[model samples]
Target: MSSDLFDDVFTLEDRFYTEGYNQGVQDGARAGRIEGRSFGMEKGFEKFLESGRIASKSLVWANRLPKNPQPGGASDEKCSEACTLPPLPKNPRLEKNIKLAYALVEPDTLSTENSDEAVQDFDDRVKRAQGKVKIIEKMLS
Candidate 1:
């Protein structure tokens, strides 16, 4: 009777152990995916920042030209003046929207406590940027 009691007491249940291990694995995978997605978004935001700077510069240069550029009708001197400025590959509104998006991505003035609001603001800025991109596309075509 003592041997039987000892055997039963010392026996381990593999099922519970396996369940715990599997749960841990699932939890780890979920954590890893969340971290990976956040990292990827940060890297992408950095790239967008660089592009935004370039587009902003281009828009500033284009602003040197007359609001209405008559390419064929403008005089030689006027054309020369316009030619000195950088060509506008995209709409100025698009560049402005991109700048706004860049600012929203990581604003230095925003506090950690307002992170949720900042995220909502960022989403709105991104939507505006997307709309501006569509407008630029239409203008180009």
Candidate 2:
């Protein structure tokens, strides 16, 4: 081939290679961002569900316990104190679960995107919490 033709071919090849490389980089970066965002949102939503579970579980156990009786007249105070129900025993396992739940739903937590899977997961968690509440009620009863 002539020198000019050879030079022209080389230049065209270099231009096509550069364009392809640049396009690939852009495409790869865009895909990476999307994947990262989706993964983060899923994790965040899981934490949110955990927080809900903690709240519901705590509520189930807390208000069920009887409160201490108030003291009346001086003469009756002693009797009232004795009649008051003893404090309910704390469940260490429940406390640990509550603490974990609180940590999961912090203000700085990331939010899940609006997707079918996320919605379904959220609904499932809510149903689980409700079932727990019902079981607790039966136990207390």
Candidate 3:
């Protein structure tokens, strides 16, 4: 009877150890994937800079790559934004050009540079924020 009890305990221990090993394997796999993705993104960004679609001097601006360059992104808002992997190459002639190009990647920061149609549509929003366009939004009947 004691021998049978010992065998059962041993089997339970083995099962526990197997579960722990499997969990470790899963965690390791997930970590490896995250690391691999980060490495790949860095390499791809570097390769893109080298492709000459962007001028050598443009590297100065490109180097200022935002970590989270998505539309309407605040600082470090990468997860909230979706930056295209391959950005367009353009020859902008001014500092504003650099800023605008950066906006092309991350547009949320460029609230002022929203499309002309969008700007026209939001005139009322600005008035509302400034407390200028307050109609009787509701009537307490």
TM-score for each candidate, following the candidate numbering:
0.44, 0.46, 0.33
The predicted structure with the larger lDDT, 2 or 3, is 2
Clashing pairs in 1: none
The whole-model lDDT of each prediction reads 0.57, 0.58, 0.46
**Model 3, runs deviating above 4 Å:** 53-141
For model 3, what is the error of residue 128's alpha carbon versus the real structure, in angstroms, after optimal superposition? 58
Which 10 successive residues of model 2 have the least lDDT summed? 102-111
Which candidate tops TM-score?
2
lDDT of 3 by residue, 1-141 (tens): 899989977799889999999999999999999999899678645544432222333345454433435477546545335544443333333334444333333323213434666554344333332231111111101
Clash number by candidate, in order: 0, 0, 1
Q: Give, for candidate 3, the lowest lDDT window spanning 10 residues.
A: 132-141
RMSD of 2: 10.5
Report lDDT (Cα) of residue 24, candidate 2. 99
**Which regions of candidate 1 deviate over 4 angstroms?**
3-11, 14-114
